[model samples]
Target chain A: MTQETITTDVVIIGAGPVGLFAVFELGLLDLKCHLVDILDKPGGQCAELYPEKPIYDIPGLPVVSGQELTERLMEQAAPFNPEYHYNEMVEELRKNEDGSFHLKTDGGLTFHAKAVVIAAGGGSFQPKKPPIPGIEAYEGKSVFYSVKRMEDFRGKNILISGGGDSALDWTINLEPIANSMQLIHRRDGFRAAPDSVNKMHALVEEQKMKFHLGQITELHGDNGQLTGVSVKGNDGEIFQVECDTLLPFFGLTMKLGPIANWGINLNENLIPVDTEKFVTDAEGIYAIGDINTYPGKLKLILSGFHEAALMAQAAKRYIDPEAKVTFQYTTSSTSLQKKLGVA
Target chain B: MHIVLVDGHGAEHKLEALEGWRVMEIIRDHGYPIVAECGGACACGTCQVEVDPNWAAKLHEPREDELDMLDENYGGEWSRLSCQILMSEELDGLRVRLAPISVKEAA
Candidate 1:
């Protein structure tokens, strides 16, 4: 170990809503925060999954798309000019006897601060692909789990597999450029949002690509070049379809890493926390967002906002002891210290 | 119709499902905040919950994408994403515990 150390008023891990909000609150208190996240970008879960999906219960608006929500969050917290380090995964968290925290990442970077917040949304969400027989043979040749540069897919034969909105939406998005596109589902009916389904209907009628109700059973190719595939449909019939590329948008599962082994009580996979305070048992550490568990914890963007705002205030108190929070989220300054007796 | 006991809002809902609906939609339709990211399309693991240990026998083991989602959720053998299990009346009364996650965590 090289033995490096840093100092700050607050050290926030996982730059999700809670972490971002802490910067705002810290700014109001005239304090500084160092934010670290595993992702290359901010907006946490909103940016990662369903960037185009609409979110309900954000307080003012009945609905906002995930991507748009992320944009707004970044804007609101931007005024604080919070510091951040991206593409870094936190591997360890340690606290000193004087009530300070130390953070280390897999990339050999370390951070030191007075307090830490765990805002990693239900861990990290990434795309998942089905295990088609012989599929591994096509890796990097013609199969992909996520969309990498938007320009890469132009003018190619593509087949998208999934019933959820993303799989369907991609079908609609890629229709114009793809030499031809096809949507395949295990079921005849789709469960995607109505708007996306409608778009697909228009594309299907226009003969843009097509839809097949079934699963991809096998991948066929010679010399690492994809030729076609075998499908099992709703009618229990197997058929061959010719295509050059295969895309499976089956979606990803939530993952929490070693934190699950830190001796925290978990109800299934979610870490248990105080319903009112959102504090984990580890003392001086807290978890907010989708990874936390409590009674009636609605998994909504607005809910995360509430949890983040409140937790930020509490973490301030944990560190400052003398800091005052008005409206709970007001972090402008210690200007209210004598007025409040929290210390 | 198949029956599945879902863990929701800290309480398990003994949900009854139609033949075609995914388990994620079943919990959501019953008014639970399952927050099926990717809308239960399995693109995200926000709908994760632990399978009822005894009922695991009846349910098909989650495939790679589903297992990967579990791994992302700090998955253990007992953990599963509800979206991966479709409803079948045969699963009626199966027991499960909802994973401790907020909609934000799943996102």
Candidate 2:
């Protein structure tokens, strides 16, 4: 929780493919970058949503998985030694009196940067809450999206929902401490790893925990404290399951959080930026990737890559107005090759 | 081909559908509210829709991967990821309601 301020040449607000590529483009010009992402990993949607899914239109690479692209981008940007601050969302952004920008993350870290790059693909990834009515009332008190501390659930009755890895993993991890543990899902089938699923079944077979085939329909609680949940079974039977704590792992979804509060003009949840330079309405602040919009904007990864290259040049000039930026290709420029450590 | 879409407010809008295009794409292209976060990869279940029970029998059963995604996203008996539903002559005039989760909440 220490309020420490870090100084950097540029601060990128996302660690997605475009943000990672921005490091290479900015690094080529000797501008050090620090990237902050809400997800725990470097790749944004590529890592979270469909890491194993194949992408076809990356150019030159006929086909590649989302994860492989992220790895290659990280490797390509590695020579620059870009600093990554994962699991932190840029919460506050302000322009300094001297024209430099100041940024703060939800994790308490702050940054003072000459330029800011908004490569946030679809804003931040937030846990998807179940559509159960009144579920928000119990959130943070007795309903938790993620487990921060296992000890907090000791001696409590817990009901876990969803059939994903997060749900199964937490059920096994928290079974030992809970007085009673129950798992509910729309179907008996699980998307989690086989090993974890087996372990959960073993716990259920031993009468240590209970597994129910149903989806949560209603939450019953009082004053932010959950008492039980009403579940609709796969057979259309409605039943009540008693639990002091409810954990619904419905996976993650993207939201345009905090970014709307910024002064940047937004067009239907996307930042409006120029085709050239990709600069936003705010000076020294640039937008790229899917989060940005223009007259003929196409939300494509290759488009974001092109935008990154242009943004780097504009950012460098904005940081130092007298600085001369000569356009050179990585294949021909000895200086660029040296920077990429291939010389 | 066309399909009837019931929005979040229960307003029905008939939208033209293209052959071989996903129902999610049709809804999105017609300026309807749908996240389709994964862009038809069938990875995210944010593009969920509630198929009319009469029309549900006309469509093919969901695969294991789709079921897995639906299980994680609180999909019910009539729930199906619209991204997995490809439009065809048989699915013309299909009726489906957008799930509450699929529509973006008013900011």
lDDT of each: 0.70, 0.92
Pairs clashing within candidate 2: none
- Measured with C-alpha atoms, the lDDT of residue B27 in candidate 2 is 96
lDDT by residue (A88-125, candidate 1, tens digit) is 77777777788777777777777787767677776755
* Highest lDDT scorer: 2
Off by over 4 Å in 2: none
Estimate, for each residue in B47-94, the C-alpha lDDT of model 1 and write its tens digit: 777777888888887776665455334344577788888767667776
Report, for all candidates in order, the number of backbone clashes. Answer: 34, 0
Residue A160 lDDT (model 1):
85
| TM-score per candidate for chain A alone | 0.61, 0.99
**TM-scores, all models, native as reference:** 0.56, 0.98
Error of 2 at A41 (Å): 0.5
> What CAPRI grade goes to candidate 2?
medium
